[model samples]
Target: MSITLSHQDKITLHTAAHGAVSLMVAADATGRPHRAATDGSIALGSATGLVGHVLAEKIKDINLDGKSVAELADHVLPALTAAMSLLKQQAPAEAANFRSTVIVAIEAAARTHQAQPRPTVTDMIRKITAALDAA
Candidate 1:
């Protein structure tokens, strides 16, 4: 049977991953001139934090019996999808760019987490950023 982490441990893990994601996003969110590798770090950082907050509120219900990576995606994907939809409705232009990047990042993260034998917060963020860079 899979060992369950204490609530605090789970929070710590989420926080670490979220922090990494935020930094990555902010590095590329400079807008207009689009600093690319730099501006997104801030935006990513904020987005991860927002996702973490949502996850924090729903932590107890997150099923961990399956893969931990899938569990993480389950916690964060819906929020990301909703955010993307909301952005699309409120800011079509921004959404065009954000949607692809966010979706790419999340998918890459999920893939990386699934493939890795021992996934870490840094690993997930790096994979996501690498995917974003490739895109």
Candidate 2:
């Protein structure tokens, strides 16, 4: 079945991706460095923790509109990679952490997106008819 995203849904996805990347950049700017014997050196910040969580949750709800997992990954990978690159320049340790976190989050979102039930043709027709009748 063919699937489509409303303009608003497209905007939401775009905004969410941008916001997540922006947050990561902000985190890199503000993150604190720590040196530990066991853990070595790492950077930590609220923004760092928040970026992955927010992106994962926001991306999870995005309407893939019948796209395959690969398609979804293709769509999001660029943004994630760009963010990773930015983080790498500012904070190498944090970049590594962000890379792993983003990968896991994206994979989880892909699974969640795939698991969601798609609207059947009949469901679509009914909704369209209801809208027409209301109008």
Candidate 3:
């Protein structure tokens, strides 16, 4: 099925996808947050299908400039769930694409640690996964 999205919906998807990387960057404690963010963002940029088109847009509507993790989560986690809910309603296959896209991005972000991700990073990943599942 073909899915349509309003401008706000596009923004929400962008914010949710990129905001997730931002969250991972924030949670990185190994002092390589930039690398984590870069890797995660690269993963998002490589997304396929409709999710890719939406994510590839140059959107300035995203407002993830939160001062703290809690502040960021206030918008991101819900956006994650909302993105999933919307996609699941309009395009179930794309919903799965979106979920996998996000998970891959977060995993790319976490991989910056070389060994295992730190506890905080792992916890943040868990929260992200939970938010996705909450949809």
Candidate 4:
């Protein structure tokens, strides 16, 4: 099915996707945040379909900047839920696609190191997943 998203909708999707990666990077306590960001971004770039198209754009309206993880989550978590809610309303398939894409990116970020994700990272992932599923 075809999906029509407004400018705000597009921004929300973009922010949610990238913000998820940023959260994962922040969750890293191993000083591999840069690598996590890079890997997560690569996964996002590999996304296909409408989610890919939306993410492939050059962002201008997104403001993922946050002095703390809490501040970032305040913006991104809701965006995740909103994006999912909107997609579910307009295109159920795209909703699932978006969820999968975000999950892959986060997992890619978490796997940046040889060891398993830290407990903090795991908690962050849980929070992100909850936000995604909150829709």
Candidate 5:
């Protein structure tokens, strides 16, 4: 059976990353509610935020093992160009956010599934992220 990420799952995952980033930014901006943890954990925001940070970090290794800039540029530019051309024809802000949310959800699901062998998610986010970056 094919595995998939649900909408709720995506929101939770993205919220983690987005929330952590926001908290870090907030802390830096406001400079309050800060405490040094005795335990070895980076204080960002909530568990979801932490998970996002960790996931983002883990993906760096995968990125290192994947395609080079030039190769990815060649592979992704055409599709991006075409897609952007289409997106530009219509208002794409909401659509873009939806796309991003879906992507993050897919990533979270993949991460969960990939923790075991016979990975069901199969690293969909990494591939998508790489392509998006290249594009």
Candidate 6:
């Protein structure tokens, strides 16, 4: 089945994905784990004024079929590209890091899942952050 997301959905997802990378950077800067930072950040609603609500809602609305991770990446490429452009301008290093982290995460997730259950945004974030930390 073909998957579709609205422009707002894409933007929200992009923000959340970027936020995940930002979270990793914050954790690295503070010498903490991504999970810890995620907890503290959520408790403080650090992203509340930015894209929290939209991210949560859009995540809930997403439903993935039996698509490959590469396909999934392709589906979101446009949104990712747009976000990367802005990120590159604001924080080039973080943008490069986010790009690498996301690509690796997608490939690993696809390998791990194969064609079983579809992946969720939360799952993707968890995997991505874990992979980032391990690397």
* Top model number, TM-score: 3
For residues 64-121, what per-residue lDDT tens digits would candidate 5 score against the true structure?
1114433433433333333333333343442354335434443333322223412212
TM-score of 2: 0.30
Question: Which residue pairs show backbone clashes in model 6?
Answer: none
Q: Give each model a TM-score.
A: 0.31, 0.30, 0.97, 0.96, 0.27, 0.34
RMSD of 5: 16.3
Q: State the lDDT at 55 in candidate 4.
A: 93
The per-residue C-alpha lDDT of model 6 at residue 39 equals 45
116 in model 5: Cα distance from truth in Å? 7.9
Instruction: Assess the local accuracy of residue 39 in candidate 1 as a C-alpha lDDT between 0 and 100.
Output: 38
Question: How many clashes show up per model?
Answer: 24, 0, 0, 0, 1, 0
The pairs that clash in candidate 4 are none
Global fold similarity of model 6 (TM-score): 0.34
Q: How accurate is candidate 4 locally (lDDT)?
A: 0.92
Residue 88 lDDT (model 1): 46
Question: Which candidate model has the greater TM-score, 5 or 6?
Answer: 6
Q: Write the per-residue lDDT of candidate 4 for residues 56-93, one digit (tens) a residue.
A: 98879998999998999999999999999999999899
lDDT of 1 by residue, 69-118 (tens): 55544544343444444444444544455544454444333332234323
* Tens-digit per-residue lDDT, 9-100, candidate 3: 99989989999999999997455998999999999999999999999999988989888889999999999999999999989999999999
Give the range of the ten consecutive residues with the poorest summed lDDT in model 1: 27-36
Q: What's the C-alpha lDDT at position 90 in model 5? A: 40
Cα lDDT of model 6 by residue, 56-118, tens digit: 343443322214554443344344555455545555555565555454433332333335423
Q: Residue-wise lDDT of candidate 2 within 22-125, one digit each (tens)?
A: 22222222222111111111111222443434334434444333144334434444444444544455455555665554333322222222343233322322
Best by lDDT: 3
